[model samples]
Target: MTTPAVDADSQLLIHRCVDCRRWIHPETERCPECAGELKAEPVSGDATVFTFTVNHHAFHPAVPVPYVIAIVELAEQPDLRLVSNIVGCAPEEVTIGMPVRVLMEQRGDTLVPVFARA
Candidate 1:
């Protein structure tokens, strides 16, 4: 099957089961809850920092040190979260419950969704 196209202006898309009304992450063809067909749906792109860690050591030469890697919970639903890097601010300034908005960045041919302080 062909992969779904993601637009640069679009927020992250999740799969929603029409029958069960359940949201699925990582984009799947079938709903895990009820064997139903799934559809791609756009999210609000608003989130809160659930937890984070500051990486002080540069893992790669191209990447700078003192960056933040965080798990942010979507405002739409509980447990609907994504692992992304927090940008537009200092790593030490990041905190739990901090409000954030999605910012798409082009990495090669893919558009990755990162978060920035709102």
Candidate 2:
């Protein structure tokens, strides 16, 4: 099967290869390992903070300083992770192995998934 283009709604789904059971992020047409068909699957949205950094500089004018940018590992599989912002708490409070859950925030027309302390 062909991989579909990721959009506002589809971003909630994680693509995986049916044959090899390999997870594909950012979406892809074919499985890199086994050339298997890929399918979009829903995740539980539970994750843990694998690592993070508190950015003190504002790269954009509207964004506040000292926001936590973290790599959170999903509960579904090991090493399956996404880069997202840690919310619902202070940036300094975020730590490695911290439990988190996904929360969708409306950004423009899209709902961006962010992690928050669980």
Candidate 3:
């Protein structure tokens, strides 16, 4: 089993069950429905803002205040959602059901998935 692949344009890491064809997040070793093997794969960056919040309080020095934190539904699956920041635009411009695209950002040792207006 190889490690997951990400960091490409319009790519987000997801695990797909080989047997059931179900997409899983917070990854599990096997498919809960079929007990099948899982494969790490990249999904198209297309998504929609399901919900969001604008943080006005600074929590970290490097992170600026008034950032948009959102729950976005991936285009691959109905319930396939992830927590990500809305970027490449202002926080006030974000809205529910707004289309967004994935963009990877380097934070420390990890590549974080962020979204921008599509």
**lDDT per residue as tens, model 3, 1-118:** 2223474553677899988999987678798889999997889889999999999999999998889999999999999888889999988899999999988888887777788999
Cα RMSD of predicted structure 3 = 3.4
lDDT of 1 by residue, 1-116 (tens): 22223554566776778898877775676988789998878778899999999999988887788899898888877887778889999997999999999888777778878899
The number of the candidate with the highest lDDT is 3
Model 3 weakest lDDT span, ten residues long: 1-10
> lDDT values of the candidates?
0.82, 0.81, 0.85
Worst 10 residues of 2 by lDDT: 1-10
Against the true structure, whose TM-score is highest?
3
Please give the lDDT score at residue 78 for candidate 3. 96
Instruction: Supply the global lDDT for candidate 2.
Output: 0.81
TM-scores of all models?
0.84, 0.85, 0.88
Write model 2 residue lDDT over 1-118, tens digit each, in one string: 2222334554456889999888877566898889899998777788999999999998998788889988888888898878889999998788899999888877777577888999
Off by over 4 Å in 2: 1-11
Error of 3 at 38 (Å): 1.0
Residue pair clashes in candidate 3: none
Q: Candidate 1 — worst ten consecutive residues by lDDT sum?
A: 1-10
